[model samples]
Target: MVGWLIDAIKKDYQPPISKVKVGKFNDYVQREYDFDKLEKKLLGWE
Candidate 1:
């Protein structure tokens, strides 16, 4: 397993965003995830 930031620095690479995205695919943009609605649906609540 390789570290993104470490590898980037080693290769002198720069990313579009300055945020450190770790342990997952870096495809997800920052967004508001409605966990409350998801939980309601999971519990079958209206």
Candidate 2:
């Protein structure tokens, strides 16, 4: 449908920007303890 519309309109329609993939776990931290500030905050650390 989009291709047909583009062809009919004869206009260059730029597709939407691609999304950033973050679920691959490539940049994920395996150790939760590394986030000491968050752990402390959750533990009621002032």
Candidate 3:
């Protein structure tokens, strides 16, 4: 049963992001937010 499930997962797995797309996403996020401040606020540092 577990082996079957593992095989199914391995068959379905894919890289969620390609390298070129990864950089665009990072640039979009940084342009859209003050990420460091957002992180600190979410972490309760501020």
Candidate 4:
């Protein structure tokens, strides 16, 4: 399921910014929102 989602995203998603900026944004969001926790929740672990 997660692999399919990632594959779909890779097929259909396009970022408006550069890879560096995307990485920075991901880091910021992870730090700000505890994204690992969010992922666990999404995967029904919490």
Candidate 5:
């Protein structure tokens, strides 16, 4: 297990999000999401 971990650490670990191409994630220019509704849904209030 230690040897495997060392080998894995030597390699470049690409996350799942690395494959996805997207625009500026934090850019709030056009107002894409309804954050109020999303918050309500997350809190089980919707």
Candidate 6:
């Protein structure tokens, strides 16, 4: 019963947005490193 309901919902659902673009690998790595440094500072890491 629950499985049937979930399947029906999945069949009917549609995403509103389309087209996701990712930046270059070097840019992503730099951004991630910056975020990690900020997070560590927030957590009081040395």
Report the alpha-carbon TM-score of model 5 versus the true structure.
Answer: 0.33
Each model's lDDT: 0.82, 0.76, 0.79, 0.77, 0.81, 0.77
How many residue pairs of model 3 clash at the backbone? Answer: 0
lDDT of 2: 0.76
**Candidate 2, RMSD to the unseen true structure:** 8.7
Candidate 2 error regions (>4 Å): 1-34
Q: How should the candidates be ordered by lDDT, best one leading?
A: 1, 5, 3, 6, 4, 2
Alpha-carbon TM-score of each model against the true structure:
0.34, 0.25, 0.32, 0.31, 0.33, 0.27
Query: Model 5: clashing residue pairs?
Result: none
Q: Flag regions of model 1 displaced more than 4 Å.
A: 1-31
Q: What residue runs in model 4 are displaced by over 4 Å at the alpha carbon?
A: 1-31
**Candidate number that wins on TM-score, 1 or 6:** 1
Residues 1-46, candidate 2: write the lDDT tens digits: 9888978677676778999875875776666465788788889984
Badly placed stretches (over 4 Å) of model 5 are 1-31
lDDT of 4 by residue, 6-45 (tens): 9978899665765553355455433368889999999999
Q: In candidate 1, where is summed lDDT lowest over 10 consecutive residues?
A: 18-27
**Which pairs clash in the backbone of model 3?**
none
Model 5, span 1-46: residue lDDT tens: 9987787788955556566677888778676898899999999997
Model 6 agreement with the true structure over 1-46: per-residue lDDT tens digits: 9997898798995658877797676674333367788888999994
User: Which RMSD values do the candidates have, in order?
Assistant: 12.6, 8.7, 10.9, 17.9, 10.1, 9.7
The clash numbers for all candidates, in the given order, read 0, 0, 0, 0, 0, 0
Q: lDDT (0-100) at residue 21 of candidate 2?
A: 70
- Candidate 2 displacement at residue 37 in angstroms: 0.2
